[model samples]
Target chain A: SAVISQKPSRDICQRGTSLTIQCQVDSQVTMMFWYRQQPGQSLTLIATANQGSEATYESGFVIDKFPISRPNLTFSTLTVSNMSPEDSSIYLCSVVFGTGGYEQYFGPGTRLTVT
Target chain B: AQSVAQPEDQVNVAEGNPLTVKCTYSVSGNPYLFWYVQYPNRGLQFLLKYITGDNLVKGSYGFEAEFNKSQTSFHLKKPSALVSDSALYFCAHSNDYKLSFGAGTTVTVRA
Candidate 1:
């Protein structure tokens, strides 16, 4: 199992501003992923961060709105750019490990409230 | 694309009683299924997974899950429920690198 941590566990920001959430893993991992969960809703995959390249985002999500940076294998940051009230949600980071393994260890998540 | 379904919005079980959280999935080709638990203000904790193994898999906190390929189901079970067991549970399915999650089910264990 992997121990992941996020910064700014909860924050309140004004609309039109940007908030960058950080994710750090206790150990190196094969892959890292970002997710968003709306209040009372299911979790949605935002993007997959690569070690030395651009992140791969899911459908209906673009890098312009959720820019991701992964400078190394153990750390990554996801920035919610040009935030709106609709962007208020809990963002979680997950790391993939174990060859041919399906389990993903997730971080506690950063709760963002866009006002 | 793969999808998961958690049939119940909430499940209620008496403490010391057996509990089961139902989960079903739909995917093309092979399926990688997993269960997760989330406490208040906490992250989703890995419970158990059924990739390619025996029908039943055991996990932390005295929890177990059974993988039934014919039903496309992987249900979480516990012989005894604790008050601490009251939390939200999510079912997820993986096809490739991405893992899809269900809406999640809130479980309340009564003491």
Candidate 2:
């Protein structure tokens, strides 16, 4: 299993402000992903953070709203831009590791509350 | 297109009783099903997965899941429930390295 950690475990920010969440893995991983979980809802994939390149975002999410940066295999960041009340959610960092990379491990999410 | 469904929103069980969380999947090819648990204010923890071979796969925390291809179901099970087993459970499927998660089921095991 891969050990993952995230910065700013919980944060409260004013609306229209931006916050960047950092994700670090103990070891190199093949794939890194960011997810969002609304209050009392299931997880939704936000984007795939690719090392040394731009992140691949899922539909309903765009780079302008959530910019991602993956400088290397062990580190990545997701920035929530122009946040609003609806942006208040738990953002999670997940990675795929191990032999076939079938299992994905998640970091203790960053809980953001946009006021 | 590949996805998993957790029909029940919540499940209640007593300590030492059998606990089951139902999950059914729909995919174009062979399914790669997985179960994960999330405690209060914590990240998700992988419990078990069914890739191939064994229909019954055992995982951490004494949890197991049976994959029934005929029913397109991979339901998580535990012979005896523990109070600590109370958490939110998710069923997911992987397609092209991307995961599609179910709506999640909240399990409450009361002592």
Candidate 3:
């Protein structure tokens, strides 16, 4: 199990503004991921933050829209650029830990409301 | 592509009764299934996972899931329901170090 925390637990941002969410892990982890959960919807993987490298994004997401930075093993950030009403969702930070890396633990999540 | 499906959108149960949430998965070779719970205004909490060797796996908050290979199902169950257990539940599977989650199921336990 891992203890993960995200900054700006909840925020309201005006349209066209950008917001960066910070994720901090108690222990160093090899894999860090960012996810988005729309209202009443399932989780969608945004990108995988790699330490000292560019994040690997999934289909339907791009670096220009959702940029990620992982400077070290224990910390990462995801920035939602040029936000809109559709971008209002709960952003989550997750890490794969334990011996076999079979389980993933999630942070409390940042609830972003674009107005 | 690997994916999981949750058949029910919402499940309502009475307190002290049995509870069940259904999940089925589709993957290439072997499946690594997992279950997670989310309360209102909170982050997701890992409930249990089935990597290998176990047909039935137990997890936090008295929750358990049975993995049936032939049926392609990993269903979560609990003997007794509690009002506190009312929340959203998700079923997911891991492939290539990435997870694909199923549509969540909302559970409502009435007192």
Candidate 4:
């Protein structure tokens, strides 16, 4: 299993501002997934970041709103642009191991509160 | 596509009592079922998984889940509940590379 570390465990941000969350994996991986958990909602896939390529965003998500960057195999960044109160949620990054996809490890998550 | 469902929003259990958290999944091919626990302000910790072989699988923290092919269910269970066991439980399914998580069930254990 890969150990994932996310920065800014919790943050209070002003509306219209922006915040970036960093996810670092202890080992190299080909794919890193980002998810959002809104209040009283299930975890929703935001995007899949593949190193050396643009992220593949899911439906209802756009590049401008939630930009993702995978600079290397072990690290990725997700930025919430033009924050609003609706943007408040826990952002988690996960990495799957091996071809079988038997296990997936998640980061503690970045708790963002937009006010 | 793969998806999971947790029918109960919350479950309350008395200390030392047996507990069960229900889960069901849908996938195109063979299903990989998993149970994860999440404490407040923490990431999801993998408890157990059911990929192949035996229906009954044991996981961390004395948790276990039984996979039923006919019913398409993987229910998590604990022989004895403790106050420390209170947390959010999520069921997931994987067929492709990504795993789909359920809405989550909050378990509150009363002493």
TM-score of B-chain for each predicted structure, in order: 0.96, 0.98, 0.98, 0.96
Better of 1 and 4 by DockQ: 1
Question: How well is each residue in A1-115 modelled by candidate 3, as lDDT tens digits?
Answer: 5689999999999999999999999998878999999998999999999999999999999999999999999999999999999999999999987559578899999999999
Model 3, residue B55: displacement in angstroms? 0.5
* Weakest 10 consecutive residues of candidate 2 chain A by summed lDDT: A96-105
Local distance difference test, each candidate:
0.92, 0.94, 0.94, 0.90
Q: Which residue pairs in candidate 2 have backbone atoms (N, alpha carbon, C) closer than 3 angstroms, thus clashing?
A: none
The TM-score of candidate 4 is 0.94
lDDT, candidate 2, B1-111, per-residue tens: 678999999999999999999999989788888999999988999999988998999999999999998999999999999999999999999876777899999999999
Per residue, candidate 1 scores C-alpha lDDT tens digits across A1-115 of 5578999899999999999999999899998999999999889999999889999999999999999999998999999999999999999999987567768999999999999
Tens digits of per-residue lDDT for model 3, B61-81: 999999999999999999999
lDDT of 1 by residue, B27-81 (tens): 8777888999999989999999888869899998899999988999999999999
DockQ scores of the candidates: 0.86, 0.85, 0.89, 0.68
When candidate 3 is compared with the true two-chain complex, its DockQ is 0.89
Number of the predicted model whose lDDT against the real structure is largest: 3
- DockQ of prediction 2: 0.85
Q: For model 1, report DockQ.
A: 0.86
The C-alpha local distance difference test score for the whole of candidate 1 amounts to: 0.92
Collision pairs in model 4 = none
- How far residue A33's Cα lies from its native spot in candidate 2, in Å, is 0.4
Least lDDT summed over 10 consecutive residues: which range in candidate 1 chain A? A96-105
